[model samples]
Target chain A: MTQTAPRPTLEAVAERAGVSRATVSRVVNGAHGVREALAERVRRAVEELGYVPNQAARSLVTRRHQAVAVVAAEPETRVFADPYFAQQLRGISKELTAHDNQLVLLLTEGREDHARVGRYLAGGHVDGALVFSLHLDDPLPALVRGAGLPTVFGGRPGWDEGLDDVVYVDSDNRGGARSAVRHLAGLGRTRVAHITGPLDQTSAADRLAGFRDVRPDTDPGLVARGDFTSGGGERAMRELLDRCPGLDAVFAANDLTAAGALRVLRERGLRVPDDVAVVGFDDMLPVAEESDPPLTTVRQDIEGMGRLMARLLLRGLDGEAPEAADGAPVPAASGVILPTTLVRRATA
Target chain B: MTQTAPRPTLEAVAERAGVSRATVSRVVNGAHGVREALAERVRRAVEELGYVPNQAARSLVTRRHQAVAVVAAEPETRVFADPYFAQQLRGISKELTAHDNQLVLLLTEGREDHARVGRYLAGGHVDGALVFSLHLDDPLPALVRGAGLPTVFGGRPGWDEGLDDVVYVDSDNRGGARSAVRHLAGLGRTRVAHITGPLDQTSAADRLAGFRDVRPDTDPGLVARGDFTSGGGERAMRELLDRCPGLDAVFAANDLTAAGALRVLRERGLRVPDDVAVVGFDDMLPVAEESDPPLTTVRQDIEGMGRLMARLLLRGLDGEAPEAADGAPVPAASGVILPTTLVRRATA
Candidate 1:
């Protein structure tokens, strides 16, 4: 076995500096009230001996771990398959790194792991938490709140009960969806249809509401349900084609769904923007750009949302005011909702 | 502002149990020599008070943080764009969770972040590290070695200097590439072309060596360089086509590259598996399964590699022998190379 050299100790530094261990401790920890001459001697001795402070001992005195927990309640497959989580994580990681805080990821498989997460959070490991609770029925938010840890959510949490002070960062899903549908309708497509994502998620429900805002009295046959996946989109698209073959346009809930719809349209020998214009939400670069005709979609700053979540939580931890994107102070409970834009591409 | 009740402390538990603080600490720390009745009383007091151990305080005496650092030396875009990192993280997360250990993710953008990562590792914040150093000349390994942290590499590292006991977990990239080329050769493909990933990565270099092992006398024009991306694959495919128009088959370094190659082939009006057969590596489900005609590729146990890396590191930290996938004890420095298999699909 390869052996490493013994690390320099605080005692050695104190002895080398001709000072007591208590004096050296105060200087090493940056605690004031030490003589400048003695402090300088200790600093020089520390540098010469290459003494590194033990984080555990420092954290015990400071009551700060310098780490934050990033908890996501999603299956591994789903988390890896979608780009949304990746973008958000990148944003969170960057923000946390900038603040010199460590990101301790806690990925929960399901309800079974919720107790474990709650225990870990309450165990005083991390200074705070950045949680992603997408589904309305997910109990993670409630559990985290019970843990008494400062937390900022990744998206608009759907739970209504005990949500008074639950802060989160989310894209304007309804507004984005409205813009997509309005764009399609403005293109002289009177017979427009909508493909909805899983309604259990707040984002999906909001997108559906946005679609309804444009086509309030549309026929039930024009709306088909998708699970925000390519396969789901294909099935939904085929169902829409069967129920309303004369439909001139389709707005999917997300880019992955749109990619599936495009494949189905191509198989049915339909030309995009000619036979049937299509618009999708979430301009996920890989899916939106790589699609057959590319995809005209709503662009949300996914990474920004993540960064904001971290900022909000960190601010809360520091007892500072939370700020919006434009640097305006936001009430602690109100949270921030970022606007989305329509990205034009070949599809619509 | 909403305020949480103060947490119950060890002193509170001690008072409740009618014992000294030192007695409560001994029982809570599971120290031997405590009377069974006294320990039971202390445990009851802890449960009644809902007292949770302070990780920092406990870590001071135990010298164990119950945390591991996962360091990846890749830009956020690349790490998220590819599915490999996600899959590996999932595997590592599962194993760590089972062991009641936390995973601290440290993502480095480039050379600038190396010093910060080194300082963190040297600070003794984590028990060990799982490092992913892809490039041949990456200096991270040397820095980590200097920090004297037990580390397990995600992929086979390329550095040869001071590499006596460097442990790593890697898929048989060369063997997997050889199998892909041999499968193409078995189909009577005499002019088999190869598209390579960035040559700086050991995996890409090993795959290229495997291709040479099969087609020792192949024409130089049959090879093109790709950066393991769809765009890179498209350019490489077009170059291969221009250089050797008669090439019957192409083996791409990864699934994303193959997807790009497939798109270019379709645009040029070539029938898949008829006019030109294509094979890819790393059967990343999304890209491989969603490509034009799906993709015939080599499957590596990516998640398993992560799990093994964690297992190896944890065992080393515990002063136990490192075991291979089959549970056979191996020398620590020998490392473990997992086997890969070929998965057939529509394209080939």
Candidate 2:
């Protein structure tokens, strides 16, 4: 093997600066109670020696990697194609950069890749993890918990055991769906149909439940299932139209689905808000804005939720006490659910 | 600090398996010349102890971290919003997962973050890097080269010095453009206009060269500049119409631009293929297929390029000799340019 260039060590810096190892360590860690003169000497020595503090070496001594893992649990293409993950990732990037931490992205494809992720997390490569797009019955949540590392879920996780103990941030899915349906109802569209996302995930299920809360006796034919994709939405809308030709309104699970539904409505010679008023969830700016007729949708603070997830994990890493209620410290498992708002647009 | 659970060491595994320390080490590293019975014993002991090989420890011993940094050099929302990155990431993720390597995602927001990235790469946290979306004035390429870490550029990089030494993977932009113009000429469309992407990028520049290659003395008014976005495309298309209202055909630099131009044409009451024929680059499925009239486009193997980049970096890590021609070893800086094909669709 070729000989590699040697890096300067803390001991070398201490010797050059005429200080003890402890003093150099304190200066590097920015701990209080260090003499200003000694700290300056160490800093100057570090600059002269071009001594970059090796994260691996620091991790070995302090048991902190100064890095976080972001596991995007998207096994299929639909979730990855959604602008939701990109917006959330942008927010996470800003927060992580501010903290001087690294972001390790692990995109899990399916069950086969889960073991690899489990080993990586358990192997002490990162201090904490932020996971997203978890599906019901996924073994990843359990494996992540088993790793015994600080973790924050991006969405409302769907595991049976220790459900209340999982730290997560989520939008008010049920409430958003309720508001969307109510908007359609207020628009006086009585025969309202619904196009839900895949029923396997919690967000889709919650949205379906919210739709039922508004119209309990709706025709079974009026409800169709989509996969949170425009293609799937088009298919579902076509089925709904065939089953209930007189339906006057539709609530889609997301903006992409709404875009698809709009295409079908236009093809079928139906004018938006006149033939079928439409409302979508998660106002993904590009899709919602670009869709023909400009979809009326529920706008969740997706980026804000992403920022919150990172902040919560960092707080746990700092060992700060969790917020308390009634003089009792709340469990770290507690999460924050951000509110969602309905944005009125040309569609409704 | 709270006590962390002690991890089982090689010595402990050796003792449990009734093997020597060297034997256990060889088994863990997958070295050859180990007896089958002894290897099985060591494997069982490791399983019983739940030993996950410590990446940090292994990295220290082998000088290989098994982690590669993927720097998304886009601070703007456009790159993230584009499905291009998602496709590339999927390919990179699949390849890295297969190799049991981790991906460290470094998203640079602006100039300040560039310094942070330079420091991180120079800090020895990862083995190699894969950088994307390099702009004309980006100093990242030079910094990465100075850090002495192996790197692969996603697109044709925009560096001026040692241009032959910059390893990258790019599509045949000039060739693709030639084919697009040829198709228009074959249709006897004389007043062909061009919507060009930002000139700083080599892809956009090369596409313009190809357009000029076909129409050497085309009217100056036929060329308009766009920024590889739908909005930019709309503005550029309007400008092209203002300059040459009777233009019969257009070749957009990208699909998003084409989509934008199509919308403008619709608003202006021009018929597609009848009044104006359009062709776009980057056959992005959703955009190309979903446009009002399915777009004719130049299809580049984006995912394949991403996979090849990861493969090249991994090969460098493995110390494999580069391919040779005429009995001379090829230079490591050599790159591959994938081909592009024109797919005929509704508009053209």
Candidate 3:
């Protein structure tokens, strides 16, 4: 016990201001019917007494918690391993903090925790939710909808039914992938191959789609599957090399995969750009910049996307139309898709 | 907008249960005066109506929010760049979630946000707080104490005054550093050097102290300053090399620094272990295992420390003495310090 003084109560403030408790409550709650002179006296008394209102009591009257739940249906290990989640959380925290709202993080480990999350959301502990459910089979999006809370998804959700009414923020995955492959093509690489991330995730699936849009007629042997890990990238790169020995370029789903591919190419005594031009997505600084020859990859504004999601949800909560970063009104359902850029580096 | 049904109120449940609203409140709040028969009837009514108690209203009675605030006074960029914070958060989230408590993350950007954090803690929004203030000069601990909220620190706080009354959980940083240096010495590397992280952080200071414990009379020229980044490691390594070219071994403050040292050593045409054996603290998987020859380093149970911090706070909230991981009662003020291990790898 650090000898803390007892908190001042509404009654104490009312007494100091020479007003009824009801009048003080009305003034503090910002109720419009209160007279200005009485409210001014109450405010002065509150300042003098250093009175801080009880959040629970205030929330009861306003029906607002000044909090938003950030729900992510991913194992703790995965969420912590990747920097993508960290960047997005930073964006959400900044946006929410600016509005004086708290970020209540709800991380679910597996299917068993989904019910708990749903119940928490429906419990009205937060005004809205920002959900990140990357996998196509993830049940989180549906469960969140069942909670009937105002929510903005972190990425374009995989669900089909009722998706037209859902709001989301996503990087232009397909467009970014196209730009990467096009860069390789322009460099005169005819035997360009693709290494895909787990197809279960929408980002991975969309990147694979973009690869197809460019080399639709290419042999299927040029495509190898990876799980977006360095180890997975190594295995996929080996498989690609064994299947298509003449491949002159490789486009990996993300930077980690690209790093793995780079290591394998180095072990095989192949020179980057000279023998095999490699490009990756995400351009995650530590990975992309540290890879051998560095990585020429697609750079997505991950933090910007997170900020946009929070902004959209906050705007919707305020009964205003959702706006994109440029302040242009967007269709609520379509949400906003931030563009990505191709960052050229030594590898390509 | 999503056709959500209006929430069933306490009055509605009370009417259905054939009891007064006061009785329903007592029953739901687990107040002992309520008869079991009436409590059962109220419970049945609650279940049938799918009535989720309003958190705000319920909190007004119990004075418990079932939530804990995690305040980290680090800029978002720095916090995100390091995996340490993420791992700790995961551990805290797991322990808190298992207790049916929500995690309210409060990240401060700079000194400007201190007042806001202090006010929020004092606002009675959460039951307690878990603070991570690594720097010695950080004002968060004082602010948190001023708020008079029950708090547990994530790391060993650097403050001296009234520290005996504070509860915290931390890794054995000094012991870990000692092990890393001892291993290098056992390998017969006598001319060893050190690269230190920012001395402002207690962890960095403790590690530097540990290095001195093993080599108390070592020349000052063998030690160089680093900020726990690869670039910092590179610059520090260059300085150490310029100052003590005959040094046979180098101990880095962390894995990122070790990775940087390895790169610089390679560029300087020095063979790791053969020419200059290297050891790093924090066997951070991505950096340690991914380093050129893989880094041999000290491994601290970062996530375990987070879990212990939450456990200590939760136990304190329950009016019980804090206990260490081994189930022995610990002095409240001394708190708990988890042990670390030396992980053998190629670099050393």
Candidate 4:
């Protein structure tokens, strides 16, 4: 093995300063309890020895690393390829930087990685965690809970049980879908079809629910599932057209899917907003603006949601926010649901 | 403040097991020197007490954290919005997982973040670093060097001094640009214009250099600067057209820029390949494949480069790789350059 010079330790600094290890550590850590003269002597020793305090040693005194883990359980490339996570990451990074905290990103690959994530959180390497557990049957919510770390979920997790007390920051998925479907219905178009995102995710399921809420007695054939990909959207759109030839309006789960459906509609020589009105969710600007008719989409403040997630997490970690009017400790249920608006364009 | 159960300490476990602290530590760390009977006793005590060994204490003994910092100093939103960094992150995650290490992502926003990054590295929180110092004036390359950590740069950093021994992994940018320009020239398209990505980045500069190397003494009006955004590409294309209206071919620095140029060309009543043959670099599939008429561009193995960066850093940390003719230590210049290929499509 290649040899390098040994790093100076606290013990070496203490010996050089003719002081106890505690005194040297206090001076190095900037603790206020050390005497000025002794602190100066210890500082001189540290400078002379070129001592960089060991992280493990420093963390023991401070009980913090000023770091947070951002876990993304996206095994599929489509999710990352899209700009959704990118925008959210930007928001999170900005907030973390402002707070003088470091972000440790954990992109879990599959089921096997769940255990690794669990171990990392349990190790107390980070102050808290901000997790994106969007899909149903994601064991991360439970694993994070079992680890007992302060965590904030990015999106509304798809869990029917054991997550009511979990803190999360999510866009109004059900409400956004309601707005989209209502807009389509307001266009005097009956036989409205819903192109759903992957039903395994809560956002997609919620959107489907919103659609059903509007057209409670509609035919089941109007709803087709998509995996939030252009190809999947195309297949779903084709199926919907094949099943419901008279359908005049559609609400796609996202802009990319809407773009795909638009392509199919154009190929079939159907005019948007006349023969058929189309509205999409997540006004991810590039996909939304680039759609043939400049897609009318449900605009959620994605970056704002990301910022709120980090903010809520940091506040929870602080535990001294003046939110408890009753003088009892603040509960962990600081769940936030941001509003979404309909972005009108030529497609609708 | 909220109250939680205090974590059981090593002292409690040792006392409960009626063993020395050293013996308990050895048992907890899975060291083989301890007697099986004593180890069993310690394990039982640990289980009964529900003691999770403090990572700080464990790290003190091991002198390692098994973590690496991934610093991306890209302030521009366009960079993150692209799939380039995401694909690289996936590759880095996969490779780090295989090696049983953790990834700590540091997204530096501006010059202010450089000091924070430097302090974190010098704090010794991670064993090594993988930095993407793309821009010419980025201080990260210098800061990382000053920290004296084993670092592997993700791209060919732009530095005229003090980085001769810096190991990096980059795609064959110059050769890729050459192939693109040569392909357009072979199509009998004279007065070919070039839309360059932000000149501050070495990749863009190298591609520009490659263009000039082939088309020596080209008119300055044929080169338009773009900021690697679709809007910037459109603006640059407009400027190029205004300066040299007869330009029959275009080579954009990236696919996003090419997409923008395509939009402007179409709006100006010019048909691609027939009116203006186009070539682009960094055939990021989403942008390249989805662009109108599809983009004929340079394809680089972005994920492979990320994996290579992590691999080189890890190998350096291992310090036992056979690289010398006479069993000497491996030099610090293990730079890797991956080849890029010209992907032919409808545009050209």
Instruction: Quote the positional error of residue A298 for candidate 2 in Å.
Output: 5.6
- In the order shown, the candidates' Cα RMSDs to the true structure are 16.3, 15.5, 15.6, 16.3
Highest lDDT: which candidate? 3
Tens digits of per-residue lDDT for model 1 on A286-333? 889999898899999998888888887767555565444445454444
Shares of reference contacts reproduced by the candidates, in order, are 0.22, 0.27, 0.25, 0.29
TM-score of each: 0.65, 0.67, 0.67, 0.68
In the range B1-348, model 2's lDDT, one tens digit per residue, is 999889988778888998765456546755433567778999999999988766754554247767788887777355566588878877776666667667666665566667667666756667778888557887777677655466788998887654554568888999999999999999889999999999988899999999999999999999999999999999999999988999999999999999999999999999998899999999997899999899999999887777767767776666564232113332344577888999999989
- Which 10-residue window in model 1 chain B sums to the lowest lDDT? B322-331
Model 2 stretches astray by more than 4 angstroms: A1-66, A163-165, A173-200, A204-299, A320-333, A340-348, B1-63, B98-100, B123-125, B181-193, B214-222, B237-251, B258-279, B286-296, B321-333, B344-348
Candidate 3 C-alpha lDDT tens digits along B177-279: 9998899999999999999999999899999999999999899999999999999999999999988999999999999999999999999999998999999
Q: Which candidate gets the maximum TM-score versus the true structure?
A: 4
Which residue pairs does candidate 1 place in steric collision? Answer: none
Q: CAPRI verdict on model 2?
A: incorrect
Q: Where does the lowest 10-residue lDDT sum fall in candidate 3 chain B? A: B322-331
lDDT of 2 by residue, A1-348 (tens): 999778998788989998766456546754323456777999999999988886854554346666788887765354466568878877777676667666666655567777667766766667778988558977787677655566789988876554544578888999999999999999999999999999888889989999999999988999999999999999999999999999999999989999999999999999999999999999998889888999899999988777777777766666564232123232344567888999999999
TM-score of chain B of each: 0.79, 0.78, 0.79, 0.77
List the lowest-lDDT window of 10 residues for candidate 3 chain A: A322-331
Better of 1 and 3 by DockQ: 3
Please, what are the lDDT tens digits per residue for candidate 4 over residues A1-348?
A: 989799988789988998766457546755433456777888899989999988865664447667788887775354466589878887887777777777777655576777777767756567778998877887877777655466789998777553544578888899889988899888888989999999999888888998888889989999998988888889999999999988999999998899899999999888998898999999997889988999999999998777777777766566444332223232344567888999999999
Residue-wise lDDT of candidate 4 within B99-184, one digit each (tens)?
76777776655768787778777565677789987788777778876664667889888986534445788998898999999999
Q: Against the true structure, candidate 2 has what lDDT?
A: 0.79
TM-score of model number 2: 0.67
